[model samples]
Target: MNCQPWLKTLVYKCINIEHSCLLCSELAEQHYPLCVACEHELPWLDEHCLRCALPLPMAGLICAQCSRRPPAFDQVIAPWHYGFPLDTLISRFKHNGQWPLGRLMAEMLGLQLHHRYLDDLARPDLLLPVPLARRRLRERGFNQAGMLGRWLSKALAIECDEQLLLRTRETPAQQSLNAQARQRNLRRAFALASAASLKGSHVAVVDDVLTTGATAQAVAQLLREAGARRVDVYCLARTAKPGQA
Candidate 1:
């Protein structure tokens, strides 16, 4: 009997329901398991490229890479820079199977998206989680993006389609790859579901983090070619450029 699957299920089902900060173990003042002071200390995104959400020095400015060659996605929405506790939280949720942490982040991200909608940020017609390769999914026992999309769907009342995209082929991990290599590795890696119909529809790709934006770009390009009017990437954090972090 393989206990790994059962353990995974247990991890997903069990959550820290107490209103205590996941970070410092203090009583959470608000609904989230995070206190106001700890939340304020998160590495919030200050300035970034309008297209890829790459951290920048100033607002209302596009990064050099985007200016030279715009990506397929229209824009990226992220709440924080991938640093310190943010990175640690994401790592635990992703690799260590601590799903409650991911859930908390997704909830806050949903709130941020709701506020953005109120400020003229267009609401997407559908939320599409980036599909995990079959092998990786089997190894991890869960897809972080899919979970995030499910939570966001409920919070925002937007439909989430887990079957909208499929990972066509398994590829090497993108963590060690540079931008060009990452893009090359993702080529022909994703395919739209045969029954998907996105003609003129606005869609958002949900993921845990946007590092090189290569995966998001590939997914967005595929959706755009499939008749999606606009494709945006929604993620929890964005990493600094290579060698900058």
Candidate 2:
């Protein structure tokens, strides 16, 4: 039997152990690129909305926004709150092209999903990265969400189709807008490259963060309309509601 994969993993572990933790200068005690302490200190999401992953007072309840108008996506799986060094890492990876940082987060997210799948989270048939507008793609040099999807595809053995979704037009950044304005900004901003590929398929839309979730809703609606059986959102982090701590 081939031992290359095992050998590579062993070698990687040897090297990883010798490095320092990304968050702290401590030895990387964990098998990953972080020490146990640093990893534990990250802003892990605990109780959150069952539907949108929004931070809530308790677990297993849908947020008011989702209750008022249910999203097209069936569920959202995010592992962290958008805060602290986690947010800094994401911003650096997204804006400054710090790919290794992004990969580290994606690896962690993939591990979380793997455990969730063993429980009740339904494994999706297809991983679709929310496509970026052509102009933004050119300016950013790479699509961070696409990278996350591809990495997740490898880790979870899922089929990732980067070309399945297409951003037909550019919209203003969603960060500055509230949920309603964000929905308006994304109107007609996305399209599916091929509806046939999504027919009766369970799809997970991979993204970096779930803020207002306007983009996720828009894409999920389109996919559902095009015959997708179910669509879910997978992202690194979720932000709190407007007024909540």
Candidate 3:
């Protein structure tokens, strides 16, 4: 089946019109959503905990926190730190309803996956977004994580099962809580939707940001419980310090 000519034209126009970085409002020089300046200025967290992707004082395989209590996901891949133009872009995407920004974030994330996590980027068996609660979904009109998951799946040629993970409860935002409190709040907040599709699969969980990583950890734990062989995290940004969580 072919899309109607008028509809196709409309879609093309929508994608082409003077696209600019959401933060700088400068013309984007590349196909990706962010402008060149914004892209170059992205705060990359190179020295981080390999397991959690949290910024660390020195290069190491694991951070003290992850050592004390390991995260559910085996590994994390984040393209940038949660700050400045990247944070502004994320805020616009989540709070201001800028849907296209999700795709852009996914593109940058895909690049990171290719460069940093080369072994895993070949393609996961499935890509799942950390599910949002019904109330939050209603308020936001979209799940930013789900949107990114779809885009990432397409880019990576992996299947995206938007319904594989379910948020069992709506917890308060982790931004206002300490690490311990964040973990407690997110406990029991997620579950797998089905065991059939999950059994023996390697899944990649997508999220727009990783703060305390409580939400991702919960989701990954549930996926593993449901029989997923492995679960890795792919987030657009990671929080820099402790208080940010």
Candidate 4:
């Protein structure tokens, strides 16, 4: 049967408005859906660790914490600090079902990945999200990391493997714990689903934020144990402080 024209028109309008530029509430002028002003205001990270992507003070190549005890991931890239409007944006994206922000964040991250890793990001064999535990996933009705990973994979033209990793244990929220407590809470919280798909693959792990780097470290360690050749983290935001847990 032929569709009704009026209904089709209404659907089209909804789609157009939904995809409109969030910055200006109009059609986007660039590949990313943000207007220039909003794009400029984003807290882009600069002078961060080449390995950890932690914001670094002047005259230091690596943060003292990473120098003292390095994480398992080969590198991390977080384009923004998790503060101010970025924090609000993440809250909306995670708790209020603001999916388009995920796309915008992923686009920005893809641009940063291009500028930072250059050719290496272009050639990653797979993309994996830091998995959410099944209970949390059910409660939240979605996994924010998985949403970010899918968007990133599309932007970077990489294969996104949603099942590559699994959160095998549920832990208390990291916000409530100190660094040592957070580390202890997250121990063995993640596990590889199976080595068959990930064997000898270079995987880029995606997440919305890197706070203490504990969760990402655990996931990377599991990936390596499952025979992943290399694992790098791609996050939308990172906490500003070194000792936050």
lDDT of 2 by residue, 1-245 (tens): 99999999999877666657777778886666788887888999999999999999898888898899899999999999998979999999999999988998999999999999999999999999998888888999999999999999999999999987889988888888888999999999998875456779899999999998889999999999988999999999999977777
Q: Which stretch of 10 consecutive residues in model 3 shows the poorest summed lDDT?
A: 114-123
Error of 4 at 115 (Å): 4.0
Q: Which predicted model would earn the best lDDT?
A: 1
Better of 1 and 2 by lDDT: 1
The parts of candidate 2 lying over 4 Å away from their true place are 1-17
Which pairs clash in model 1? none
User: In model 3, which residue pairs have backbone atoms overlapping below 3 Å?
Assistant: none
Where model 3 places Cα greater than 4 Å from the true spot, the runs are 1-27, 116-122, 243-245
List TM-score per model, in order.
Answer: 0.92, 0.91, 0.84, 0.84
Error of 3 at 40 (Å): 1.3
Weakest ten-residue segment in model 1 by summed lDDT:
9-18
Instruction: Please give the lDDT score for candidate 2.
Output: 0.91
Note each model's CA RMSD in angstroms: 8.8, 4.6, 6.0, 5.5
lDDT of 4 by residue, 125-231 (tens): 88888888778788889999888888777877888888867777889988888778888998988776654566787888888889888888888888788878888
Q: State the TM-score for model 2.
A: 0.91
lDDT (tens digit, per residue) of candidate 3 on 1-245: 77699898999778776677765778875676577777778787777898988887677668878899888788888877887777888999999988777777888778777675466443578888888889989998989988898888878778888876788888887778898899899888887655446778888888989888888888888888888788888899888775642
lDDT of 1 by residue, 99-173 (tens): 999999999999999999999899999999999999999999999999999999999999999998999999999
Candidate 1: C-alpha lDDT? 0.94
